[model samples]
Every structure is written in C-alpha cells, then in structure tokens.
Target: MKLSRLGPVGEEVPVVWEEDRAFDLRPLTADIDGAFLSSDPVAQVRVALADRRLPMVGEADALRVGAPIVRPSAVYCIGMNYAAHAAESGSAPPEHMVMFMKSPNTVVGPNDDVAVPRGSTKTDWEVELGIVIGARASYLESAADARLHIAGYVVANDLSERDWQIAVSGGQWSKGKSGPGFCPLGPALVTPDEIDASDLRLRSWVNGEPRQDSRTSDLIFGIEQIVWELSQYLILEPGDLILTGTPEGVALSGRFPYLTPGDIVELEIEGLGRQRQTVVAG
Candidate 1:
C-alpha cells in the first residue's frame, strides 16, 4: 500500500493512495508519524479499506504532496554505500560502514523549492532510496533481522554543498548537508510488500539534463546491512529516516556543473516515486 500526506506544509492531512485515487485517512489518525506507524498502520489501513471506511478526500493531482511522514526523530545517512560513488570521490570501499546525520529540519516536500545556500556555488545533488523504520531496532543480530524492522521506502534527494562538506567544515559532511530544505523526500511512502528495496533503480537530473543514473544493485552495503550495522550503535526508532546513499554519477564527480539558482532538479526511484524541485537563491 502507498501512503502519503497532502495539503500545505504543516497543515497536511494523512492519506492513502489506491487505484490512482487519494483517500483521506484523517478519520483513522491525525497524522502519519512514528506513533501511527507503531500501531501497525499498514494493517490498520488494510482493515479500513476493506470496510470502506476511508473517505474520498480529493484528487491526487489536486492536492499538494507533502513528505510522506511527519518529522522523524532523526535522519541518518550512509556515506559512499555505493562502490562506484566511493571510487568517484577518490576513496576505496571502506572496511566498515561510514555513517552521517542530516538535521531533521532539512526535510521538505518532494516538490518544494530548494534554496541554494547564500554565496554558495558548489551545491550538488544525490538521488537515494530512503528507509522508514516501523519498529525500534537495537543491536540487531543479523541483516535478515534488520529487514523485519523496515516499514517502507521513499525517494530522497540528498542535496549537498561541497565546500562546506569537505574543504571548509573540517571534514564533517553534515555541515554541507544540513542546509534547510536539503532533504526533499517522497511522492509517497510504499510498504515493503509493494516493492523490492534491494534492486531498484534510482536517478537524478538537473535542468533536464541527466547527472546521475544508477541502481541500488550497485550498493556496497545494501539496505539490510545498513540497518543492521546502524542498529549496533544507535536505536532505530519508528519514523526514523535512513538515506542509503547514492550511486556514481553526481556533480561532485566533476562530470557536470554544480546546481545554480533557477535550476530544476528531478529525482526518481522505480516503484517508489519521483520528485522535482526548483533551485532558488537563499
């Protein structure tokens, strides 16, 4: 099942997408957040649909699509989880997983405008698969165990400002990554049963020109390993978002010019959905 939130920012109402239509789930819950997911939202939604209890809220195209879930406890990210991306950045595959964090405030609607940091010229884009956790996970025993904790997936654009990330921030990537609106997520949140998170294709483009084209098959550390490894150190809570990293083709590889004001960035994950954001000067 595909779930979503719609309406203006901060006023979004929970919804479920089925047969190309949007049904209001507000009667079942106030918002799609950690608490809602903890209640086995998918099962609840199923029962609601079976009972014909959901109301037809509005046409999918008529309402503004907000990020599928509400503010998460944290937004965790994996660095260079794709071997090719690691190589492009002049690094070898790491013996251990590399992790980072993006300020949760960076989150925004998938189609919202992305603001270029003031005086910045090295802004870049990364298309990644985002994992939404449904249960608390800590010190998981194996990758297989990690799989059971996943609730769903979403398309994510991990926007970055290269200078702040590498050259100017004393080596912390979050400095460049935590800019407001840097994380544009979702067209919808799709349950694990609805799609294969292991081998989906993810791509990105700037100003209608392809910049990154790759698949999750190329990930050095797949979703299961990422979740399992992260669990060893931090507790993965319901509604926590984990960006699994991007593939090789990115502006940071110096193959294309970095994003500029007025540039339109598009990102898509097969089966998950697509996102389009217009870049504007801060």
Candidate 2:
C-alpha cells in the first residue's frame, strides 16, 4: 500500500491507504516510531483507514508531504553502473561496482529546490532509480535473493560538482557528491511489485530541456546484483536507500552540458513517478 506522512498545522502524521482513502494511523500507535511501523502497522493502518470507524484526522487540512523515509541509516550509491555513462567518463566498464556514499543530511523532499553550493561551478545532475530497503540483509547468497529485501523504488537526482568530485582531494568522488541537498528523492517509494524495475525508461531535463535519457536495460550491474554485492559488505537496514546509478545523459557525460544556478532539474523513471527542483545559489 502507498504510505505517507500528513498532518494538521504543525504536526506531521503517519498515514496509510484504507478503503481508497487516506487515514491517520499515528494516533493508534502513539508511542511507536513511524519508520519502524513497516510491518502490520502499514497493514493495520490500511484496514483502519478503509473502515469508517477510524477517527478523522482533523488536522489534515494543514499537512505537508515529507520524504517518505524520515531517517535512513545510510544512503549508498553506485557510480557509473550504466555502460554508456562509463563510456562518457572515458573509462572502461568496471568489473566490480563503483560505490559511494551521500551523507544522509543531503536528502531532501523530491520537489524541494536544489541549493547550488557557493564554490560550485560544475554542478551536474544524474537521473537514477532509487532502491529502498524493506528488510535487514547481509551477505546475501545471490542476486536472485536480493529482491526479497527491497521494498520499492523512487526517482532521484544525484546532483554533483565535478571539481569537488574528481579534481580535488586526491580525486575522492564523494567529496563533491555528499554536499547538502545533493540527493533529491521521492515522488514516492513504489513497492517493487507495483512496477517493472528492469525495463523502465529513465530521463532528466534541465530547465525544460532533455539531458540524460536511457533505460534500465543499459545498467551494467542491475538492481538485484548491486544489492547482492552491497550486502556482502555493508548491512542493509530497513529504510536504507541505494541509488542504482544514472544513465548516459548526465552533464558529466559531456554530450550536452553542466548545470548553473537558476536551472530547474526534472527527472523521472517510468512507474516511479517524477521529480522537479530548481537550482539556486547557496
């Protein structure tokens, strides 16, 4: 079921689908953490919402949507998983996955404006498929088993600064990618069963113009394999998000160009929904 946080005036509430309507579930489980309610809490919330017996959320009129996951333990990313993106970087496809981390502080609402860091001249955007972990997993035996731990997907823009990424600090990429507001996540976190992950079209546009365009089919290390590989090292906790990598159309790919202040970045993955944000001076 599609779950979200809504509320009245200033308080945010946990809500779930019930009988085709949204209902507040937080009141019933007052002391429980919303993120930990992934199990029957979601199911109960759905049922309670469906039934008219549940109390009406009097504050619904004032609610604002927040990032679906409040506090993910970690945000991991796969770099250059798309062959064409690797080719554009002038590097051969790696035999092993290229991994990086974006600080959790960087996560922002999908529709929020992207803050262009003061020193950034080469701000860029990457359209990617975001994997939200549903269950704890570690040392996964195989790719086939990886899907079991995934809850769903979301569209993400991995905003980057090429100079901070590659040209400085001895070429540590995360230096540039981990900046605040670097990760724009969620139109929604769609359950894996709700959409086909392997064949969707991924696209990004800057200021209403197309930039990156490619398909999941071009990914060198697809979702399942990437998850399996990641599980071998880091423990994947519930709510941890992993970016499945971007396609060949990123500004870093050198086909079109890089982003500047005042540019609006828009991205979408078929079935995952869409995200749009404006780039502004820090």
Candidate 3:
C-alpha cells in the first residue's frame, strides 16, 4: 500500500493512493494524526487499507503532499555513494561511508518551491532514494537483517548551497545542507513489499533536460549496508530517514551548474513515484 500526507503544512492528513484516487485515512484513525509514513505506518496502513468500507478521495481535492515522514528523528545522508557520481565529484571511492545530517526542519512536501537562499549562487539539486526506518535497529551484523528494518522508500531532493557547504563552516558539509526548505520529499511512501528498492531506475531533470540518471545497481553501498553501519553509531528510531545518496549528473558533478530562480527540477525513483519542484530566489 502507498501512503502519503496531504493538505497544508502542519495540517496534513494521512492518505492512501490507489488507482489514481486517494483514500482519506485521516478520519479513520489517529495513527495518521501526524505523519504516518514512517516505520510503523507500513503495517498500520496495510490493515487500514484492507478495510472495504473506507472512503476514497478524488483527484481534484485541494490537498498538499507533505514529506513522506513528518518527523524524522534525524535526516541522515551518505556522500558520494554512487561510484560514477564519486568520480564526477573528483573524489576516489571512500574506504568507509561518508555521512552528514540535514536538519529535520528542512523537510517539506514534494512539489513545493525550492528556495534559493538570498545572496546564494551555488544552489544545486540531488536526486536521492530515501529510506524510512520501520523499526528500532542498532548494531546489525549483516545486510540481510538490515533489509527487514526498512519500512519503505521515498524520493528526496538534497538541495545544496556549495559556498556555504564547502567554503564556509570550516569544511563541515551540514552548514550548506541544513537550510530551511533544503529537503523536499515524497509524493508517496511506497512500502518495501510493493517495490524493490534495491533495483530501481532513478533520474533527475533540471528545467527540461536530464541531469542525474542512473540505476540503483550503481550504488557503491546498498541500503542494507548503510542502515547496518548507521545503527552502530546512532539509535535508528521509528521515524528516522536516511538519504542513500544521489547518482552522477548533479549540478556539482562538474562545472557546478547550479539552480537559479525560475528553474524547475523533477525527479523519480521507479515504483516509489515522482516529485517536482520549482526554484525561487529567497
């Protein structure tokens, strides 16, 4: 079952998308009182969607799509996890995974406008496959167990400001990555059972041309390893999100061709769904 939050920010309602129509799950249960796309929602909604009496929503409803997970305890990201993207960024494959955090407050619904911060010139876009942890996990020994902990997947745009990311903050990448509106996630959260997150086609387009395009097969570290590795350091909470990282063709891959006002960005991961956003100057 596919789950999503719809309506205005802070007032979104949980919904299920099926056959192009949305089922209003908000009125049916409090599990959806807030964002219900995190870990447990996978099982919760599975039962909810099975009820034949639930009311279905129409396509023209004035609902806004919010991030798949409303309150991720932490937004973890892996840097250069794709081999080709690593090469394009002028870096050799890392011996160990590189990680960074994007503040949970930056989360917004997909299709929202991406704000290019005032006086900023290096704003760029990254199309990444995002994982929502379904259960509490830590210190896992193998990739097989790691897969069981993932509830589902969502598409995310890891918008960046190169100057603040690298030139400032004394080299800590979080400074450039933690701005408000920096992360736009979800059109929906597709349960892992419904889609194979391990092998999917991921692509991004800036304006009208393709920029980042690749298969999940290109990832240097698949979802299982990354999740298992992260659990060793931090407590993987029920609603935490992990951005598995993007593939090659991001604006920063070469020449640093970043986004400016009036540009539109569109991205999608097969099975999970698609997301689009417009660029606006702050």
Candidate 4:
C-alpha cells in the first residue's frame, strides 16, 4: 500500500493510494507520524480499505503532496555509501558507515520551492531512497533483523551546499545539509510489500538535464546493514527517516554547475515515486 499526506504544508491530511485512487485516512489518524505507524498503520489501513470506511478523495494530482510523514523525530543520512559516488567525490569507500544529521525542519513537501541559502553558490543535489522506520530498533542482532523494523520507503533529494559542507565551517557536512527545505521528500510512502528496496533505480535531473543516474544495487552499505549498523550506535525510532545515500552523478562530483535561483531539480526512486523542486533565491 502507498501512504501519503496531502494538502498545503502543515495542514496535510493522511491519505492512502490504491488502484490509482486516493482515499482520505483522517478517520483513522490525524497524521501519519511515529504514533500512527507504531499502531500498525498497514493493518489498520487494510481494514479501513476492506470495510469501505475511508472516504474516496479526488485524484492525487489534485492535491499538493506533502512529505509522507510529519515531524519525523530525526532525519539521518549515510554519506559516501555509494562507491561510485565516493570515487566521484575523490574519496574511497569507508570501512564503516559515515552518518550525518539534518535538522528536521529541512523537511518539505516534494514539489515545494527549494531556497538557495543566502550567499550560496554550490548547492547540489542527491537523489536517494529514504527508509521510514516502523518500530523502535536498538542494537539489532543482525542485518536480517533490521528489515523487520522498516515501515516503508520514499524518494528523497538530499540537497547540499558544498561550500559550507567542506570549505568552511571546519568540514562538518551537516552544516551545509541542514538549511531549510534542504530535504524534499515524497510523492508517496510505499510500504515494503509494495516495492523492493534492494536494487531499485534512482535518478535525478537539474532543469531537465539528467545529473545523477544510478541504482541502489551499487550501495556499499545496503539498507539492512545501514539499519543494523546505526542501531548499534543509536536507537532507530518509528518515523525516523534514513536517507540511504545517493549513487554517482551529483553536482558535488564537479561535473555539473551548482544550483542557482530558478533552476528546477527532479528526483525519482523506482516504485517509491518522484519529486520536483524549483530553486529560489533565499
């Protein structure tokens, strides 16, 4: 099942997409958040759909698509998890996962305008597969056990500003990653049963020109391992977002120019969905 939040930002309503139709899930939950997922959102949605208890909303295209989940506890990211991306950025695959955090406030509706932070020139794009957690996970015993904790997945654009990320601020990547609207997520939250996260094709384009084009199959630290490894260091709570890293072809690789005002960025993860954002001056 595909889940989503639709409407203007901060006023979105929970919704379910099935058979090419959108149905309001407000009768079941106020918002799709950690609390909602913890209550077994999939099973509840199934019952609602089967009982015909959900109200049929208009076509999904009629509403503004917000990020699939609201106010996620934290937004975590794996850096250089793709070997090709690492090579493009002039780094080798790390022996251990490299993790970073983005301010939750950076989360925005998939189609919203992305602001180029003031005095910025190196804003870049990363198309990644985002994993939404379903249950609390701590010190997971194995990579296999990690799969049980996943609720769903979404397409994500891990927008970055290379200048602040590397040149200034003493090399803390998160510095450039935490700007408002830095993370544009959604189109829909696809449940695990609906899509395979193992080897999906993910890609991105800037103003109609293809930039990043690669597959999750190239991930050095796959989904299960990312969760398992992260669990050993930090608790993975329901509704937490994990950006599983992006494949090669980002502007950071220096092949393309950094984003500027009026540029449009589009991202897609096979089966998860697509996202488009227009860059605007801050």
Over 57-127, each residue of candidate 1 has an lDDT whose tens digit, in order, gives 85668888899999899999999888889999999988888899999989899999999999788999999
User: Would you estimate the TM-scores of all the predictions?
Assistant: 0.98, 0.88, 0.93, 0.98
Error of 1 at 21 (Å): 0.8
After superposition, the stretches of candidate 2 with alpha carbons farther than 4 Å from their true spots are: 6-12, 17-21, 27-42, 52-64
Candidate 4 residue pairs that clash: none
Indicate the worst ten consecutive residues by lDDT in candidate 1.
Answer: 56-65
Per-residue lDDT tens digits for candidate 4, residues 30-128, read: 999988887888899999999999999876678899999997889999999999999998999989899999999898999999999998989999999
RMSD to true structure for each model, in Å:
0.9, 3.0, 2.1, 0.9
Segments in model 3 whose C-alpha atoms lie over 4 Å from true places: 31-43, 60-62
Query: What overall lDDT goes with each candidate model?
Result: 0.91, 0.77, 0.82, 0.91
Q: TM-score of predicted model 1?
A: 0.98
Residue-wise lDDT of candidate 3 within 109-136, one digit each (tens)? 8899999998888898999999888777
Indicate the worst ten consecutive residues by lDDT in candidate 4: 163-172
Q: In model 3, what are the clashing residue pairs, if there are any? A: 7-64, 39-134
> Distance from true position, residue 116, model 1, in Å?
0.2
